[model samples]
Target: MPSPEPDDLKRLAERIDEAERKHAQRKKPPPPTSLGIAFRFATEMVSALLVGGGLGWGIDWAFDHWSHLQTRPWGMVVMFVLGAAAGIRNVMAAAKELNAEMAAKDLEK
Candidate 1:
């Protein structure tokens, strides 16, 4: 039935602020480690290669079986190169994003 004292109010506000700060920190995700980044890049590259090779193999098979054309290994080779390029591009983009994140974090500090 009584109002809170001034000291109690100030302490309560400080506690609330501290709790909010801790909550905010908990909500933030941890930064990626170097090993994690490397693995991500490798996974991207390998997945791209697999997709390109699979598509190329399918194309070669279709051509060989349905028509007179003979793509054989050339299709796989060319697609593989394209996949490599795509993988490289993806890595570059990821690197750029990480750089931006780092810069932002640095600025925050």
Candidate 2:
């Protein structure tokens, strides 16, 4: 078989280079979005607050009835305060997550 001509080799090289450039351009994926992060954070915070508050209320009821009648009032107050703290913590965590997500999105673009 005859060897390929220089012109044919050059054309083939150009075609290969073009293909590689196009592939590189197409392979790049879009950056992550913050909307998904925000939604997830809000969902988690709301769920945690609800579950924590319910558990706190239940424990307070049980303690008031069975375990320690003497400390019932204080226990109830403490439990309620703890529940509130948990809720506040959830909110703060969500806020932090949102801030981080926003920062990440900004950096991406």
Candidate 3:
């Protein structure tokens, strides 16, 4: 067979470079640490709890201020319960998100 010319070599090199780039693009990323996941979950839980408490307190105060509605302790109890539920929901959501994020991170490796 005839020797490959300079142009052929250049084209081959270009093809190799393109392949490498494509491979890199297809490569997966690394996963996150266990500690990092826990930290993120905890952070979200705390934030949610704080927000829920504030909202509940505000609602309770508003209800307490209204003369006609003020007679009801049910409002306060309901708001508190709802806030706690919301806080718990947020914590669960955060945990799920954190796990997903960590899984994605691991896949990127």
Top-scoring candidate (TM-score): 1
Which residue window of length 10 is worst by lDDT in model 2?
A: 25-34
Per-residue lDDT tens digits of candidate 1, residues 4-96?
A: 799998999999999999888745568899999999999989988988888888889999999999999888888888888888898899899
What lDDT does each candidate get?
0.89, 0.69, 0.71
Which lDDT tens digits does candidate 2 get at residues 5-55?
999989999999999988887344454467866676667666766665666
TM-score of each: 0.74, 0.48, 0.56
RMSD of each: 3.9, 5.6, 4.5
Off by over 4 Å in 3: 5-15, 18-33, 71-76, 106-109
Candidate 3, residue 17: how far the Cα is off, in Å: 3.6
Ranking by TM-score: 1, 3, 2
Model 3: per-residue Cα lDDT at residue 44: 64
lDDT of 3 at 98: 67
For candidate 1, the TM-score is 0.74
Residue 41's lDDT within candidate 1 is 91
Q: Clashing residue pairs, candidate 1? A: none
lDDT at residue 65 of model 1 (Cα atoms) = 97
What tens-digit string does per-residue lDDT give for candidate 3 at 5-49?
989999999999999998888644555678876787677667766
